[model samples]
Target: MKLTVKEERCSGCNVCRVVCALHNAGAVQPSQALLKIKGEFPDPGTYKIAYCNQCGICADSCPEDAILERDGEYNIDYELCTQCLICIDSCPFDVMVVTESEYPAKCTGCGKCVELCPRQAVLADQG
Candidate 1:
């Protein structure tokens, strides 16, 4: 499944990011969330949503074989990850992120981001 965005429906409330971080990382930090909201203020239409589409590019690029696919969902195995940053470099959408602690972050298709979006801007589907 892929995470699709409807820019027009986004209200810049950041509820989706907040809930995503809380659900996946057990914190309220949006930066740790798998999906990110990017744009400039004073222009709501300019907002752009960036997220993983489960295309497997990150997994394929992992030199350490840390990234894997299961049931069409891609996930990073932290225990095997070598902090190579190969996945980050291969991500076409630039959605893969590596934190200061050296943890690679990407979407696991958990659907938390879709559930908490107030405007239903983010969707998880086969498309």
Candidate 2:
């Protein structure tokens, strides 16, 4: 499973980001969410969403082999990670979230964001 975004339906609200942060970091900090919401430049009403497709790019980029794939879902193994921040810079989608105080994280296909999105903007695709 993977999370997909409907940019047209998004209201520029960041419930997805907040939920991601809570799941990944035990906080409400949207800045640490595994997904990214970007507002259109020079515009306030439009937004773009970037979410992990469970791609293994970060795992491949990890010099320490800390990023791992389990049952097709990818996540960082904190103990093996060295906080190199290389995954953050290597994400092709630019959605990888690696804060100084937190370990890197990726979507675990929990679908919390899809269940709670007020606009139904987040979808869980079984593909």
Candidate 3:
């Protein structure tokens, strides 16, 4: 399953990011979120959302096989991770989070963002 966003419906309020950050990192910091929001200056009312599609590119890029998928979410195995940071370079959506934990942040597939989005713009494509 991968999260999808309806860009037209998003208001850039960042409720999704706040929720993701809180759920994943225990903080309200948007930068810790597994998803991203980019402003569209030309159209002030709309924003673009970037979230991990679970494509497995980061997992494949890991020389140590640290990244793995479980319950449709990709996460780093800290015990196996080598701090190579190659996964960060391979992310197409640029959502890989580098923190002091020495592993990249990933979506927990907890569905909190989908349930809490005020605009109903976030969705799960559970293929």
Candidate 4:
């Protein structure tokens, strides 16, 4: 499964970020969210959503074998994680984040971001 974005439908409301941070990290911090929105106002005037595509580059790059796939979803096994940033660097979209807790944060394909998008700009499905 992959999370797809419809940039044109995004209103910059940031609901997806809020939901992601709250659902995954139990906080309201956008910086800790797995996905990010990048753009500026009154110039290009477009918001670009960046998120995991479940490409497995992170899993393949992990020397500790911390990342694993289960039931078609990629997840990190925190006990096996060595706080290495290899997965973070391997992410093509730069969506993987290293939290203040020293754990790497990647999408679990939970669909929280997609479900909370007010504009329906984010979608998760078998791609």
Candidate 5:
């Protein structure tokens, strides 16, 4: 399965970010989110949700073995992560954003972000 986000409908409200944090980390902050929202307002307002494609960049880049693969997906072990930002830099899509604590967070593929998205920008497909 893969996810596709609609950039046009995104209002950059950061709701997906918020929801991701809440669901994954049990927080309400966007910085804790795995997905990122980038774009400015009053100028075509193109907001894109930058997140993981289930790619293993972070997992392979991790030097401390903080990242791992499971069930055909990549996941971060928060306890093992040293916040090195290596995975963040390695990501081609720039989906992994740096958190306040310095660790990089990527989409967990929990589909929680999709459920909270008001615009239904995030899509899950099985093919």
Candidate 6:
């Protein structure tokens, strides 16, 4: 499953962030969102959507074997996670973010954020 985020249509209203936080952490705050939006102020702002690309870098970089590549995707075993921040630092996309939950949160390809996005910015495509 590949998640695609189209930035051209994003309004930066933060609907996707709210949805992500709600789905992953059962909260309404955008700061808790796994996905992040970075942009500057003013008209014609260039938005950057950050989310896990489902890449296996974190799993491969883990020395503790806490991260695993399962069914072609990476998943972290919370019980085994020592909060080392290795995976968070290893993410090239800067998608893996340290949330209020302590451990980093990676996109689960759940499509909840995609569905809740008002701008239709995020999408889950399985090939």
**Winner by lDDT:** 4
Error of 3 at 123 (Å): 0.8
Cα lDDT listed for each candidate:
0.81, 0.82, 0.84, 0.87, 0.77, 0.79
Clashing pairs in 5: none
lDDT of 6 by residue, 1-127 (tens): 5578888877777887787788887888777777788886675578888887787898877778888787777778898988888888888887776878688778777777788788888887654
Give the per-residue lDDT digits (tens) of candidate 4, residues 22-72: 888899898888888877688989989888878888999999999998876
| Better candidate by TM-score, 4 or 5 | 4
In model 2, what lDDT does residue 44 have? Answer: 64
**Predictions: Cα RMSD each:** 2.1, 2.1, 1.7, 1.5, 2.8, 2.0
By summed lDDT, the worst window of 10 consecutive residues in model 1 runs over: 38-47
For residues 14-122, write the lDDT of model 1, one tens digit per residue: 8887887787778878877777787767764577887888889888898888888888888899999988888888998887767758788888787887887888889
lDDT-wise, the better of 1 and 5 is 1
lDDT of 3 by residue, 1-127 (tens): 4688788888888898898888888887888888898897885656888888888899999999998888767878888998889989899989888865767777767788999998888998756
Q: What is the RMSD of candidate 6?
A: 2.0
Clashes of each: 0, 0, 0, 0, 0, 0
- Model 6 misplaced regions, further than 4 Å: 41-44
lDDT of 2 by residue, 1-127 (tens): 5777788898877888888788867897888887777888676668888888888998999999998888788878889998888898888998877665756766777788898889988898766
Shift of residue 83 alpha carbon in model 6, Å: 1.8
- Candidate 3 backbone collisions, by pair: none
| The 10-residue segment with the lowest total lDDT in model 6 | 37-46
Question: 88 in model 3: Cα distance from truth in Å?
Answer: 1.0
Candidate 5: misplaced stretches above 4 Å? 78-85, 97-104
